[model samples]
Target: MNLSEHYNALFKKSSELILSGNYTIDSKINDESDRRFGITLLVRPNEEIKANIQAFLKELKKTEPHQYYYPNSDIHITIMSLISCYQGFSLDKFSMSEYVDIIEKSLVDVNEIQIDFQGVTLSPSAIMLQGFPTDNSLNVLRDKLRENFKSSSLPQSIDSRYIITAAHSTIMRFQKKLENPEKLIEVIEKFRNHNFGKFTAEKIELVFNDWYQREKNTVNMCDLYLR
Candidate 1:
């Protein structure tokens, strides 16, 4: 299996789980979408960090080989993922333009944001590069988004807790049957001290990653920078 195959399989598995009535798609969707949240502005990796992730993946392969290999997408972090309902939630250019205006006018400014991926850690299921949050730019954008939707009469999933979520792009994911609990724990612990250097958050993009609809449009995640 290749990279696309791996992603397709994971999508299929998740869809199947939902279809089987085992999982309910409710406002509590975050618990299920650990990886897919919405369009988030991620700090692009410099050459050094890119090489490090490549080397890291290589080490991962040697530590625990699998039938399917993960394709290194080269994305360092996720800004946000489009909501699953975003496919059904149609927004015309006019409406989107108005929303953009609101976002632009109410946005906040941040000097810099940084997060260092140190070591590895195991979530409930998958292995992850653990790090602390230092980026307020993206968070400000997310907040602006909520305010934008509220004032524009656009229905949004309520997220009142204002949880400080960590931002990292998933390098790979495994199905339940394919999980190797012991090896995963071992690998995560070994790389717990892995040093991924800091990168700046210059701008955020409202990327239209509508995988289901097969459409994308990039808008500055900040309204202040809108052209």
Candidate 2:
């Protein structure tokens, strides 16, 4: 099928998945000490691109004001979760700093990556703007980091189900079962092939949790600039 047809089919399947309650909605734990550190490409969309996305969200809010929209500061494409400082697992600040150093050293030869945002899709948790990189730079970067983390003595955050094959930036999330799910689908259908613009990911960040909060935002512990 074509692009529009493909996304339409995905929308239908994802909507059904949401209704089926088969997936879990990601949430942050209450305690500050329980938050996890994640490696990610924090996207800073240009003014034109940001304005375009904000405009769409403005229109969507008219019909679904209860939906949780991601603020500009919170937008990012997660690469991999590094370590958690929760429960009996203790990752001290010094250790986290060491991991950040390792990440920086590992990605020294990587170049800036070009990414294009297009279309929109629904997931069990949120509405997302799909991201496509211009080349295999992102995949190569992820694999390099993965190998580095695997060989390190650090306590790696292991979630067997977590994988990042494709990138998507979250737009908004459902607060409750939508009163009219079709309306949201209609909006997505309109932008199924919309070009939301492009940006270069020049830096990768080691972001601390609180990145997921609406009221608050992510704190970048450190960043590694691409060559």
Candidate 3:
């Protein structure tokens, strides 16, 4: 099959699985989440800084084959993962649209946002950029979404203290076993100082991923307007 046909088939199969209620898998206790979508104010860096940071990530991916690292998407700090679907429950089209509005109303005043990826580290499942300045801004929006919407209506698990509630991006996933833990962190420490300049926090997006399909992971990006 051609590339387009191949992806189309995969997307078809994935949607079928979801509609059939067979793909609603829960994250394991130890699985660290790297995927997030929301109103993120991405700090745009200068060309030199952006190039330098990207080069660092490229080297990390090469040296650390054991960690699951995906290619870098647009760099931005996350506000929240608009809970898309959960096990045992299906999100209807209208409900999804309404809740998007609800989520928007919840975070009307959050105009300014600050973020930085200080360095990298190896989690048991993947390598992540250690981020900073965990303020109430992200959490407040999360709590309000839960309060305004029923538990089953949101896209992801909304339990208090849930790791997704903490915003951090997984830069790489170790595909193979690491021979030495010390070596992994040692490499991480080298680029630990890499930083992307700050951007104003303005909008949120309903980000979804088609994890079942290769190359089509970014399923949809729905923009959430702020007042």
Candidate 4:
């Protein structure tokens, strides 16, 4: 199915769980010993879209302030997870120049992409801004990244979890047990069709980061521009 269809399906399933008070709660949120790191290539949403989502977050906070919401700085649409987070990783082990060269070649003539963030959706763990690339540019770019990374001898475990095709940007993750999920669900339903804004990405950033992508735990690595 297409991105829109997939987003709708996910919304339907997740919202049903919310209505039935069956949404998942993250217990590890308070665990300080949790240590995992990853390398991801992602696109930051435009300021207008970020402002729009932050406004929506204000509404959600009134209903459920206990849940963790991603700060505006961390809001992004992941293009690819080059290396999913692992238990032990040495950042110095990988050559920065090699990855840069490979990715630069991969984006040789890729088309520019426009992601329209049109609504709010959710999974048991998180609330997301529904994103849809206006054309096949996103698919083409992802395919190129997978193909190029596979050909390179440098270490990369791209798509080991699953082949990513969605453009959705996760905005919030459950940090605690819901006090009244029905109330939160009502807030979610209120913005079910809200228009966040559009993000026509010009560049994608590759970063070494902790699982949460916290600014303090992240190091900027490379900038890849779209055509």
The TM-score leader among the candidates is 4
lDDT of 3: 0.46
Q: Rank the candidates by TM-score, best first.
A: 4, 2, 3, 1
TM-score, candidate number 1: 0.60
TM agreement with the true structure for every prediction? 0.60, 0.80, 0.61, 0.95
The residue-by-residue lDDT of candidate 2 on 1-227, one tens digit each, is 14345546667789787556653344443345544333343445566667778887887787677777877766667666665333333224436677876677667666777778897887776788777878877777778777887888876763444665666777787655465566766777788778999988767777655435332635566777775
lDDT string for model 1 (68-187, tens) is 223444354554332333333333322455545654554545445566655554333344455445545556765666666666664344353333255554554444233344454455
**Candidate 3 per-residue lDDT over residues 189-210, each given as its tens digit:** 5765556443334455555533
Model 3 error, position 90 (Å): 7.1
Overlapping backbone residue pairs in candidate 2 total: 0
Candidate 2 backbone collisions, by pair: none
Name the regions of candidate 2 deviating beyond 4 angstroms. Answer: 1-10, 18-41, 84-94, 211-217
> Which regions of candidate 3 fall more than 4 Å away from where they truly are?
1-53, 65-67, 74-78, 82-94, 151-156, 160-165, 211-215
User: What C-alpha lDDT do the candidate models reach, one value each?
Assistant: 0.46, 0.66, 0.46, 0.85
Span of 10 residues, lowest total lDDT, candidate 4: 26-35
Off by over 4 Å in 4: none
